[model samples]
Target chain A: MTAPIRKLRVATTSLAGCFGCHMSFLDIDERILKLVELVEFDRSPITDIKQCGPCDLGLIEGGVCNAENVHVLREFRKQCKILVALGACAVNGGLPAQRNRLDLRDILEEVYVTEDGLARGSKIPNDPELPLLLDKVRPIHEVVRIDYFLPGCPPPADAIWKFLTDLIAGRTPVLGHGLLHYD
Target chain B: MKTSNSEVSAQANARGARAKAARPAEANNVFTIDGREIPFEPGQTVMQAALTAGVFVPHLCYHPEFRPHGSCKLCTMKVNGRPTTSCTLPAAPGMEVENNTTEINDKRRLLIQMLLVEGNHFCPSCEKSGNCKLQALGYALGVMSPHFTLFYPVRPVDASHPEMLLDFNRCILCELCIRASAEVDKKNVFALSGRGLKKHLIVNAESGRLADTDFAPTDKAAEVCPVGVILRKRRGFAVPIGKRTYDLKPINEQADRFKPLTPLPKEEF
Candidate 1:
């Protein structure tokens, strides 16, 4: 008889993403049953765990758009052996980086102060609790080292499944043909 | 007159010879792409010949109907130990072309990533997400990350025209529209201005807007764009995601062996 196999510990988080990646992750559907047998969740939305423990794989979605994102990403990087940037946002700043051309102050003022529908005395918010926004939205790799990147708007559930299965089987994850898409 | 059996057989053979002369002659010249020998005619570029043979060379600005621009350089391959644009290179005998190699494909991947970061290719929100050549190429080449700083240039979207929109931010500077306008449509409604990094597409009207020109939906320039530069008024996501052209299969697999060689003259209307 051979030795028992240990489940691979995986952690995941969303920064500036729409949580579509996570939804797609859950979109793995009944494969989640098969996935659970091979991997255990840590600091994931599925577990509702806030703090990340030492993990085998870290799946991070979204770009680093603010101070809190950098802090969280750096911390997550330290605990995982391999870190994967998930989806288009984390790959290249995706849709959120569209605002990189405009000044953050101008965007805030336009939305909060000068818009036609805004109230008379409205101004940009400045609370101690709010995380300060960065001048330019950046991909996660600009802040920390990312081992692998999964591309797609929200990588198709099948793409994510293929990525995970390839990694689990000691293979360099290669998303090919129908499995790879940037949108 | 009564005909002998030998005379009738000879007449049938002569009739078949005349019919063969009427059809366009098939390509007999041969060149190798990635060690796979394919046929090419004398006038055809390597890309045209490759596509005609159902092979893909990973091009952006190349459309079969239009003349080869060779600007994108995505089709660069080692033609007998020298890197040459397959779109502009002529087919010759015993030409050893190496495409799909690890060295060449890595360069293609880098070229794509450079294009991706050089422009603001916001694929998720862009109307040409699934259908865009740039997006399809990014996936085709395994560009995991852009690996470069974003330009995020503040380019104007010319919605002055009532029927169409021109988003300059996504322009890869592929001059397909410029060629289609001047050569095919004979309209001279579009031109490129400036040099190097500052080079950009501009309308050929006095107001520098598309509305001031005689441009219409029927023009070939309106439909020759490989990216999201030229778009119609309101039908952005008409074909739902996961069902678009490149979504179902990669661009390499979609090359048609029986596709007509004529440039599409009426796709605009």
Candidate 2:
């Protein structure tokens, strides 16, 4: 007789980011095998089906800057039992937050609709599918309740692994001394 | 009048006898640091005791004459399981102190880093480049950069003081100069303004630039500043970097050896 497997479902989503966090997660290297054995990937691009569904852990990378990002984050919060804000962008808005000090209209006009720009040569329609931009880039917690936060430019791969493994084993994770505390 | 004078004399004699009776001949306790235990006279500060014990605790505001105010929070230690400022706490018996914890060192490093950022600490260009306590602490902590953004508040120099210069840029606001001026010299020439992050030293009550204040160059405040903020105008860069404070030993090690005479209550996380 074999012991029944306690399947743990997990998902990963990105918002206003360069996907550096996902790269860092991949850097877990050999530990990824151990992780895959413990948790079933649900909506991550690296594994499983692409469409997001109900999951045990929701790992969110990046801040909420656009309308679609907010919608996706809200959906994740509704679906997942635990939500982890991954990396600096999700934790404190990171480098994108530097632009938060600027006006949103100025950003749009400069990038998309200026005289020397994308909309200059053709007519640009205001489509319903296009998400509107927010005034400032804010960390995930500011918009909704975040269960855990890993703060770093992209949190060291070891930290992410520890968090995941501890959860899978049903044990409380202790942040390692001073090295783990960024603040 | 005659009765009052005789009464005063009798009271003085009684007080002198009481003082003599109260004085203890032998010291009460000795504590070990690293591996060496040193005896201290009653009422001597931990820094003083350590210095007597040949243990060096690098400090800015701690002077033998004045009271110890642990504002810098650089001289932090882990006693048993908690972090504490050492200068103000009284020494106790059977205390299990650990000053070399990575946590304590990190906190001290952050403290110095914050200090470096809070002021315009351009060591290479400043006159007090070599002998400054803040610089020494930076070198001791192995500070790479200011780490935080510089406020760069446009502070003016107080050359009004004939013999000294009060450059607010170099000021760490340790309050040593303020205390030394008020208590030791009996002159309230220096004052601190603003609060929290904005807190800084003001020369006079008016918050006028230091040059405009009625500060004497020979004021004790000018003499006591641990950094080059309050410099003796002519003596800039007199000491070379090789002979400076950081070259001696790391500040964390120096502070660890000089256990607080009295241990403060542990800080909560």
TM-score top scorer: 1
| Runs off by more than 4 Å, candidate 1 | A1-4, A116-121, B1-28, B257-269
What local lDDT score does residue A144 receive in model 1, on the 0 to 100 scale? 89
- Predict model 1's lDDT versus the native: 0.81
The per-model lDDT (C-alpha) reads 0.81, 0.63
Per-residue lDDT tens digits for candidate 1, residues B1-269, read 00010111323433443444344333447766665666776666777777788876788888877667788999998776789998887777656666766677778888998898888887777888778888777777777788777676789799999998999989998999999999889999989999988998899998999999989888899888889999998888788877887888777667682232854223211
Interface RMSD of each: 19.0, 20.8
TM-score of each: 0.87, 0.51
Over the stretch A1-183, how does candidate 2's per-residue lDDT look in tens digits?
A: 121296788999888877878898988999787777677888875774657788999999988888888998998898899998887677656567556546777766666666474544544446888888787777787778887766545666776777677667766553342213221
Report lDDT (Cα) of residue B87, candidate 2: 64
Pairs with steric clashes in candidate 2: B89-B262, B90-B261, B90-B262, B91-B261, B91-B262
Candidate 2, superposed: residue stretches over 4 Å from native: A1-4, A47-51, A113-126, A175-183, B1-27, B30-87, B90-269
Stretch of 10 with least lDDT, candidate 1 chain A: A1-10
Error of 2 at A105 (Å): 2.0
Q: For candidate 2, what TM-score does chain B get against the true chain B?
A: 0.73
- Candidate 1 per-residue lDDT, tens place, A1-183, comes to 121299899999999898999999999999998888889999988899999999999999999999999988998999999999999999889888888888898999899998998888999999989999999999988888999999888899999998998888887787777767677
Q: Taking the tens digit of each residue's C-alpha lDDT, what string does model 2 give over B48-163?
A: 56666665554666755557778787766544345666566555532333443344556766887677656655553566644566765554544333344444455666676556
